[model samples]
Target: MNKEFDDNGAAEFEKLLQGVKPLAQDKLHFRPPVKSRKQIIENSHRQTAEVVFSDIYQPLLPSEGPMRWNREDVDPVEVKRLRRGDYVPEYLLDLHGMRQTEAKREISALIQACVRQNSPCCCIMHGHGTGILKQQLPIWLAQHPDVKAFHKANKEWGGDAALLVLVDVAEPTQKR
Candidate 1:
């Protein structure tokens, strides 16, 4: 064996690689860096505007008329069924004699509880008095994201004085 070659193998290897050029930078393509899962979730949450209730009350059309609201994707037939009181409410919140502020709080809490319990329907009796509650209830219900649909209760219930609210219950998230 050659003494020089055996002793300087690393030097000889470096000499062989001296003239070799690396691949062009433009030809070495790479995908853009992906966002972390937490970052994506935070971004999504940030993009959604917070729901605010202000100046929601206005003079409703008729004092005797039934009030109704439904999401655009909800079926009209289902709304008709709700109007007819086909589905019995699992819970009820009577806001009959309560003031506007108290009634609003009760309504919010009741709806949230019902949603958490996965209750499909609920009733809110605002009564047919001076029509203050009746006028404001629809606006408040419209603002609630979980309220899928709501209509004046049927005659068997409180009729125009009460509302049959259909709540959308989100499925419980499964853990990985």
Candidate 2:
């Protein structure tokens, strides 16, 4: 069924849904909240001494909890690949000397080329400056519909100066 709503009708519908007449108000059953300050210390001198001791000499403790991060799961092959920059790239565009507008255009063109050429990955160097390029580039990159994922390069690569980008692989015939 086709449904269409006009401006006035939409407004009235919103008002009705919101119960703007105030006659349908429900009674809230929230209870009074409890408030109390904790009495942590009895004497100022004793408290100060305890605080100083705790700050200086935190004794070794037993490891009862498991680690939240996994180091062994890290792939050595992938790390080496990134370090050597061996990933087959579709295009490499340098933004080192280009202005902001020109850089954006170049990035867009490279992205289009990558998509058209069925490139799996690409690299972009934004440098570690005042974040003018770093900031603007990511915003545009994120907004790109063709971009699958993009991340900061590892230390072996350009590090934060470059990005590892994943692009949609186009059909074979579209390669340039």
Best by TM-score: 1
- In candidate 2 the C-alpha lDDT for residue 1 amounts to 19
Please list the C-alpha lDDT of all candidates, in the order they appear: 0.76, 0.58
Candidate 2 error regions (>4 Å): 1-88, 171-176
Candidate 1: tens digits of C-alpha lDDT, residues 81-135: 9976688999989997898766766777777678778887999999989998877
Task: Give the TM-score (vs. native) of candidate 1.
Answer: 0.62
Q: Which ten residues in a row have the lowest lDDT in candidate 2?
A: 62-71
